[model samples]
Target: MEQSLYLKTAISAVRAAEKIIRRYWDDGFDVRLKADESPVTEADIEAERAIRQVIQEQFPSHGFYGEEMGSIRRDAEYSWLIDPIDGTKSFIRRTPFFSTQVALMKGNQIILGVSNAPLYGEMAWAEKGHGAFMNGHPVRVGKVTTLNNAALSLGNIKTLAQGTGWQGLGKIVSGVNRTRGYGDFCHYHMLAAGQVDLVIESDLNILDVAALSVIVEEAGGVITSLDGRQLGLEAKNVLAAATPELHELAREYLRVN
Candidate 1:
């Protein structure tokens, strides 16, 4: 299939998922804990199911990797990655920052990505080499070139403090001009919108960040593992920044010594 065909399919899939998610957003829903103790809701499962069904119906040959459902034909040349609700914790807490994320990977490259923010009324999507867009307007990363002037964003501080990334976290916090906890996929969307300069997070799967990586990069920012390497599905930590200069500085701070 052509890239455009896949991109349109992904957009339709996430939008379908978003409808399912919004229907259950504020009415109180049951939550369960996965093996990692992360919160999962009916919205998450149903949203993913709807997305998978939509994608599969149109492109049966393509693969799928989603948070709610595991891999299917994962080694195929083309695959879709879905995080039905990227911040289910926030969703359960009635916070509006949660979003539905989707990405299409053509071989090793992410060809298209979308982050649909149901409550925020923002939809960020990107096609490889075509740039990123928010609500149909092109967006770019901020112009903060130096860490001393950069606003650093983070996920759960406690999780950072207890993990192997604690030292790097300390380095980053000490170097940045300001720090905020905008946690989850929204921070990357914010980065793509040019509202944020840097975002660091520990412990995430491919479904949590594959779409974000493409969106951020197409928005003229850098997205990679904490070690400053190319991002991949296996990456657990992330460092996304507005520029290569800032990304390098962040990489230095996040480096394990």
Candidate 2:
């Protein structure tokens, strides 16, 4: 199958999810807690349902691993990873930072991704070997090579603070030109569009960062776990940089004890 077809399907799925999310956003919805105590809402469920329907129509045989819904046929050669709302807490708080995330994974590799922030009116997508784009325009990461010249974004650093990498993170914070905690999809979007030079998150799920990994890499950036491993289902942290040199330098300070 061509990657363009996969990209089209992912975008269509994201659009379907956006409609459901907007409807609930305008009205009101009830929130509930899941096993992990994280919030879930009607919008999340309905959006995932809508996204899954769109993708299934395009490729019924493909598997699905969704945040709202559990995995189905997860071992299939091709699978879709869906996060109907990447920032559910933000959504519930009436913030526009939330987004619909969709990515197609062939075996262990992500082949394409689409991220849509409905209220923000921004969308980004990318495919392997093809360039990344935002709002229909091509995008790329910044060219900052040194930490002193780089702008860094941090997300979900609670776990990092409790680990051996805490000091390393402090060093990064002190050395960077500027830092912002633009947690969730917002920072990744900015990084891919060259608005930020690096992004770090010590806690996240694969569903939260899979689509983002594809976008950042396609935009001429490097993304991996804090441990310097390639992103896969098992990834728990993120250390994405605009250049390989910056990434390697950050990795040195971030090495786990």
Candidate 3:
């Protein structure tokens, strides 16, 4: 399928998931814990099922990797990544930070993405080489080139403190003009829309960031692992910035000798 079609499908899937999520938001749902001890709810399961149904109708041959459902045909040339509720904890807390994340990956490259935060009333989408959009308006990253003048956002700081890069992160934090902990989809959306200059996260899964990575890059920003590696399925940490110079500087500060 073409990139445009993939983007459309992703957007539709996100909307479908959003409906399910909102329904559970209005009504209450029971939360459960996975073996890993992360929270899960019927909203998560049902929303992911809704997303998969929408995508499956469009591309039955494509593979799927979802936060709620395990991998399906993960090795297929075309695969869809889904996170029905990217911030489940926030969702359970009645916050608007949760979002439905969907991305189409052709081989190892993400070609399209759609992130919908229904309660937040924001939807961002992008097709490879087509740039990025938030609520139908084109968006781009900020132009802050230096750390001293840039605003930074942090996520999962507790996990980051346990790593060897803690001191490095501290240096970057001290140098930045301002820092905020806007965890999960919020920071990525803010970065893509030029509201923030940088975002750093120490703990996340591919499902949490696949769609976000595409949005940031398409918006003229750079996103990679904290150590400056290319984003992949195995990526857990993130270091996204508005410009290449800012990204490199942050990477240098976060680099462990």
| Best candidate (score: lDDT) | 2
Per-residue lDDT tens digits of candidate 3, residues 47-125?
Answer: 9999999889989999999998999999999999999999999999999998999988999998888889999999998
Q: Predicted candidate 1: what Cα RMSD to the true structure?
A: 2.2
lDDT of 2 by residue, 87-199 (tens): 99999999999899998899999988888999988999999999899999989999999999999999998999999999998999999999998988999999999999999
Error of 1 at 35 (Å): 2.4
Q: Give the better candidate number (2 or 3) by TM-score.
A: 2
Which model scores highest in TM-score? 2
The list of candidate 2 runs beyond 4 A from truth reads 1-3
- Each candidate's lDDT (Cα)? 0.86, 0.92, 0.90
User: Where does candidate 1 stray beyond 4 Å?
Assistant: 1-3, 157-159, 163-165
Q: What TM-score fits each model? A: 0.93, 0.98, 0.97
Q: Which ten residues in a row have the lowest lDDT in candidate 2?
A: 1-10
Sorting all predicted structures by lDDT, with the top scorer first, yields 2, 3, 1
Question: Local error of candidate 3 at 184, Å?
Answer: 0.6
Candidate 1 yields a Cα-based lDDT of: 0.86
Which lDDT value does model 1 have at 177?
93
